[model samples]
Every structure is written in C-alpha cells, then in structure tokens.
Target: MRQMRMSHDEPLLAIDGLKTHFFTREGTVRAVDGVSLTVPRGKTVCVVGESGCGKSVTARSVLGLVDEPGRIIDGRIAWQPGAGEPVDLTTLDPKGERMRRIRGGEISMVFQEPMASLSPMYTIGDQLIETIRLHLPLGKEEARDRAVEQLRRVGIPRPEERLDAYSFQLSGGMCQRVMIAIALAADPALLIADEPTTALDVTTQARIIDLLRDLQAETGMSVLFITHDLGVVAEIADEVVVMYLGTVVERGGVDEIFHDPKHPYTNALLGSIPRMGAGAGRRLATIRGNVPHPSDRPAGCPFHPRCDAAIGGVCDVSDPPHIVFGEARSVRCVLHDDGAAVGGDFRVDGERA
Candidate 1:
C-alpha cells in the first residue's frame, strides 16, 4: 500500500446496519443480517464464519452483485473520499457509470472461485485490458501496459506469456493471481478479497497470503478479507469479526480475539484449528454439526443448538445482544449477558482467562 495522507477524520469504508436477504421457497434467508464494520485506510479487517454465514454476501452487497430474489434490503456503505465528505454507495444509481468506476477503481474485489469468476472465452490479457480500461481513462496501449505491470506486480511469472493464456490454460493459483492483477490495476482504495486462497494448495495459499500482505503494505489500501479459516484470520487479519449463522457474534483486535475469545462460536472455531506437528494421525477437532439450514435455523441464539454450554434454557428462547467489552472488544453471547452465569471474563473454550 502506497503512503496516504492519514487523518483523524474517518474510515476509508464504513458499513452500517447491512442487511441482505433472499426470498426463497424455504423462507427469507438473512444472508447478512445487520452487519456493521469499518476498515481504516491501509488496514485489514477479516470476516470469518462457517459456510452460509453471509461473509461473501456482505462483500457482494458492497459491490452491488446481489441477484434476483436476493438484494441488499437495508444498510449503508459509505466511502470517505478525498476530503471528509461521505459518499453513499447504496443509494447511487448502478448504471450511473460512477458505480462501475468504483467497482474496480475505488473498491475492487477478488472473488473466491476464479474458475467461475473468470471468463474462459477471453484471454487473460484481454480481460485485464478490458478491466483496466473500464476504470482508467487511458488509451488501449497505456491500459495494456498498466495491465502487464499489474500482472507482474501480482507475481505472475512471465506476464507477457501468461496474458495470452486462457483461464483454463493456467492452474488454480495462476487464475487467482490473474484475478488479483485485475483488481490491482484498478487502484482501489479498498479491496474485498472473498476467500482469495481457498482453491490453492497449502504452499500456494501461504504465497498468496504473503503477496497480499506485501501488496497491502505497499499500497496502504484497506482490505476486507472473507474466510471460514480461523488460521488464515490469525495469520493475516489485524482485526477479526466472528459470525454465526447470519450475525456477527464477536469482534475485536487480533490479539484479544485470539487470546481471549469470548463467544462460544468463536472459541469453537479456534479450537478446531490443527496445531503444528500434531500430525494427521490425531483426529482434528471439529465444530460438530453443520451450520443450520437457512429455512430451518434455530430460534433464539442461532448457535444455541451447537453450543455445549447451553443447557436448554433462555439461549433457546432469546437472541443475545451485542455488548462492548473494552475499548475494542465486543461479543454477542448470553453467557456474557447482564452480569449472568460466568461473568464476562469467563472463557468460551477454557483456553482464555
């Protein structure tokens, strides 16, 4: 991330009361139910959750990609432009051409599945040039040159040759690199990378993460990374948001979140990560039970059904409220409600004090 003028003014991107839902035969699935977060300029915020917990949907809604039967029903996503003025992204007309500029130019994103996201019909060079041209006012030659630079910047070996290759012609990791290159060419102030390394091998995953960290460090662009992997969150995120079902269960700085996880869901997630040298012989700790189906979600705390501490009481009768812990930590769990059971200092996984 390049050096930017940091001010005490405001965040690069701020989301408030974000609610995206889908009307399906099952019911109204709340993919992202009232999520609110901020990414300070040049920092990284990660949204970690189980599958279907609305991580991707939240990012998608930010980019206005929610399809039919599904839409961003509420909330505001505002960007702090050059000055201190707040630009409302939600109310802007999609076809105004401004949204297009912002998609790749101001706030870019790299989707999870490159195979599905990238077009096989178009060569990598063609796609990159097209995307660059969309965001920049440069001529074809300039845009192509910038695209090639972006490809090289993203660590694609032999960019000139890779540009001529089709999506299927490259490996999964290469496709993702191309995706990152396209996103980089936009010069976005904020980048939303949705599970950007899920499709790669372990070594490739580490490389991609390192590349992202390096790029973000060089550009100072804020990033919103979505993933279900707590390990990835621990490795890259400066801050963390733990989501269960469609709601944010806990949030805090990386140190506090990893060392003092409070929500049951958050603790369960941490417990499930395989420690080094544990070897494949040992059974990896699992979260037990899949995420509830959207239509058949548990009533009260959506995670109550999976929470071992819950002895079938009000956890099944009422939803827990989000409470502030300290300056930067907060949790949404009945165990921390009022001055209840174990006090707010109690551990969720018996690991934190």
Candidate 2:
C-alpha cells in the first residue's frame, strides 16, 4: 500500500487506486474500480457521470458506509483531520470508534435523498442537535442553539419553529436545507454532497448551489460534490472528475474539462448539455448508448463502443493509460496517444478536440 505523504499544503483528502466492490449472488460489482482523485483544501471537486457510474459509491466509501455485500477490497482514502497528519481511511474499521469520530465530525455528508436520510420519526431539531452535540462538547441548550443557528444560516424561514417540525411536514426544499444544516453543524473539514439538488425545483436548486458555495467560502471547507449534470458541475466545480462505468476517464480544472476536453466521453457529455440560442427546431444531442452494467462491462476501454474516435483493434483491445498533461490535466483514452490527438474532433459549440 502506498501511504500518502503529508504536507501543510497537501490536499485535504487523497484517494489512490481505490476499489470498492459488491459481492452479490449475481457476481462481483466493481462499483469503484481503481479510482484516484484529490480534494484540495477549500475547493469544490465535482464528480460527473450518469446514474450507476459509481459516483455515489465513491462518496459512500469515503464515509465508510459501504455495507453488507459491498467492501473496500483495495486502495487507500487518506484524509487529514484538522491540521493533523494524514490517516488512511480504508484501514480504519467501518463501524469502529475512529471511523465514527471521522464520519460526522471531521467529514460530513449531505446525502441525495434528504427525506430518506433524515429520520422521519425524529423532529428535525432533534436530529440536528444530536449531530451538533456528538461532535461538539456543548450542553443541551447550547447544542439546540447551534442547530437553530445553522437552520437560519441555511435560509430556513422561522428556523426556531421549523426546528421542531418533522421531515414529512416540511417541503422537499426545506428538508434539503435541513440536511445541509445537519451536515454543517459540526463544521467539518470536508463535505461530500451527493446530488444535493436532484429533485429540487430550478429556483430551489439554484439557491441550494449558491448556499453551498457561500458556506464553503465562509467556512473554508473542501467539498466533494457528485452530480451528473454538466451545468451543475460548471456552476460549482473548481476541478472536475469525469467517470464512466466505474473509472475516471478524465480529470482537469473546470475550464479545461469544459473548454478543451481530451476524452471522447467528456466531449459527448458536454455535447449532450442543452445550449441556449442555438436556433430552434433542432433536436438535443444525446450519448447514444447507456452506461454498461458493472457485471457485463466491456474489455479494454469501457467506452470504446460509444466513442466517436475509437480506433478499432487498439481501443477495444488495450486499456489506455492515464496520460497526464500540463496544468494537472489528464485523460484516459487511446485517441490522445503519445501526448497527441490521433483524431481531432470538435462537438461543443466553441471547443475542439
């Protein structure tokens, strides 16, 4: 195992060759296969891919929530708690004392389904206060005050009254805000937001995204945001990780990934995003094939069949290396062989490959 080197300016978290697999009756599902990424301090890294692309599993794995049939078979999740040394999270027992302290205290997560994540049986205030109390040494009244303060910070109207409300009583957007409050209660160093605005209305979604950005700026916390929408990625991401079936095919700064994507999958995803003022009566572009099933993943490059520039015999038989470029950009594709583009293509409105 390669231990992560610790430094004051190092990333808040570093994941290297991390593999989380699911052992089921059908077969083993390589949910997170050989994935590697870093979450720099006080920056937002967005993981973009379609549903079942291992984005959620990767986030859950970091929180040590991969349960039952699933396991972290290999790799390391090195996290820095406070200004302390880095510790490999993969080595920590999932339900042990150390992991427990890290989960809601050092690293908090706002799950996708707020209604499901928030306990319906408990009052919203009870849940938030419990989290605040667990991580912070405070009296009952103090913890309740902290919870109420967080509620207000997240833009909840009449936060004091809403604190006593149940998850089912509040609207979806309100529940989402409550979830954010619970996650922010401890003021964690890293916040893993897994599709935080999935089912929210357009207005609510914008508010939620803006709230996250503002909170990050205020708290100086790093965020690992997982979403499939490129628009959302463009809005909040400083760095972007593009995942295919279970692997990251590309990673770069937000501008590089959007403006000069090297991988075919990244290009296709950008092309699929609806653009404004492109004239009327034109059909929206779509990635033709669905993400392949984990159990039945194809050989060589996972996206070979769907790639527009896939070279037969080469792309289908040999897996591409993670070719690194200047400015920390990288792409896993045969088309960009020998640090050059074998096939130059352009699809996005103002971009060229």
Candidate 3:
C-alpha cells in the first residue's frame, strides 16, 4: 500500500471537467459531462439530482470504476494525498495495481443495494475478513478479530454469531450495516457512499445516516454522498452539488443551496420536497419533465426544456456560462449570467438586482 501524509489545507479529492461516455452501437451516451466538485477533508459533499442525472456515474468515475463501453473521454480527477504531490486519477489505468490499491484501500465505497453488493454465497465474516486482510497486514485470526470488531462498531448485535450468517439471512437493515462495516474495515481516507440509504425504510434510512455521521466524527474521513432526496441532503451534507443531464447545474454550501437556490432546477427541486405544514390536499411542486435521454441531449442548456425560467432565445441557442458567487458557490444558468439578455436584474450575490 502507498503511504500518504495528511494535509488539512487542501481538498482530499478534486474532479474537474470530468466526462464519461458510453460508445454504444446506436449512439454515444454522455453520462458525466464537465462535472467538477471537491471533497474537503472530513466534510460530506452530497451530489443531488433526479434519477439518470449521472450522480452514480460521477461517483464511479472518481474510483475509476466506469465499466466497459463507458470510459472517461476527457477531464482530470486530481487526488491530493496531503504530503505527496497530487495524482491525476484520470491518467491512471483502471485495472492497474496503483489504482486498485487506491480504489478500496485509500478510498472505499458503500453501494446503493446492500444485498446485491454483498455475495450471497459467502458468509458475512468471510467477505469482511477478506477486505480487512487485503488492506492490512494481519494473520487470518487477526483479520477475523478485526472483522468482528468492525461489525460491533457498526452496531450489529451478536456480531460474532452474525458474521457466520450469509447476506440473504440478514434483514435489509442488517445487510446494509454489514456492508458499511466492510467498507470501513480498511479505514479509507474518503468514503464514497453512492445512495447507501436509498434502499432502506424511513426509520432504517435515518439510522444509517446517523451511523455515517457518527463514523465520520470518529474517523475524520471525507464523504461524497450521492442521492436525490433533499431531506437527506439537509441532514448530512456540508456542501451540495446539483447535477442535471450529466452536468453540474449548481453547487454551494448546503445552507446557501437550500435557502437561496440560484438555478431554476435547484429551486424546483427544493419546492418539490414535502414540508411539515404544507397543508393537506395541496399539490407538491414538480419539475416539468424528466431528465433528457443521454443520447438525445438537447442542443444548448440541458435543463432548458424543463426550466420555467429558461430564456427561449439564449438558453436554447447557446450553453449557459458558469457564474461564480464568492469562492465556494457557482451556477450554470442563463438567468444568473450578467451578459444574458433577460428582463429581471441579476446580482452576483445570487439575488435580484
């Protein structure tokens, strides 16, 4: 394993202009286009968007997990390991030994479906011990002990006996917990949780979120959480990245994104969330249309077809420029562009002028 020193000043992971595409027989599918974001040390950055918005693809891209037919066409994924120089993950071979070590040892991922992610043939302990042994230099018995300790840490009751059980024998919640334990067994520097809570019930989801937060507090690992649920973002996210049709539409601090969304897509998403006192029988606000098909993406701004605030002439004819607000906030929308010909005044502070 490679040794990496820690630095608090720089971001743990930085992805810039990442584009992952699939060269299918019919047409090219651009899954992640010009997507950029950073995962600051020990912070949770949640990537939010509707289904098929490339949230999962972007996460997979970070770990060099984009499968065959789908390869990164352009862009750079710079991973900074604090002490040494920054490594551009985009240039590394996906199946190479260096990338393989970084994928699970330095950066681990908790996938969406626990049951599907874990093998039904192997006992829970077998998988967990394998992961631990692969990353750490330990004897068989030692690895097993570490596996049991991890299960206990993840709040699994009777962890020793539970380890002997297969994934199919455990409840959904238990399977998810086991998956989490396995992901953390190697003590990765960054945890890419790809909608880990999406498959659980409301109560189970809450517990899982709480567990992640607690584990982060204990381990100080940065997390890249991918999900479509705004409520989940509100609970755990320090920062938020809103993606639309494979590109980032808006990104900023969680409080800013929720309270003062700059992009129409972001506003529409916020409005769609169920509220405490929204009144009975009231229709929840919904975005006009589904995400555009990857191969059939629109000419200009991808969100224009569904955006209520889209300027017909400009948004349809040309792509929106990325507008910057302070240091940590940005939006790609004609409505926020200063040069765009629109009726309402646009301010750099993300407000009406």
All candidates' lDDT scores? 0.84, 0.89, 0.90
The alpha-carbon lDDT assigned to residue 97 of candidate 3 equals 91
- lDDT of candidate 2 over 241-334, digit per residue (tens): 9998889999999999999888888888999888898779999998878899888889899998887677777778888877889655888876
TM-score of each: 0.92, 0.95, 0.95
Ranking by TM-score: 3, 2, 1
Minimum summed lDDT over a 10-residue window in model 2 is located at 343-352
Candidate 3 structure lDDT = 0.90
lDDT of 1 by residue, 292-319 (tens): 8766778888998888776366778888
Per-residue lDDT of model 3, residues 37-66, tens digit only: 999999999999999999999999988899
Determine the C-alpha RMSD for candidate 3 after optimal superposition of all C-alphas.
2.9
Per-candidate clashes, comma-separated: 8, 0, 0
- In model 3, pairs of residues that clash are none
Candidate 1 lDDT score at position 351 = 35
Candidate 2 segments exceeding 4 Å error: 1-4, 339-353
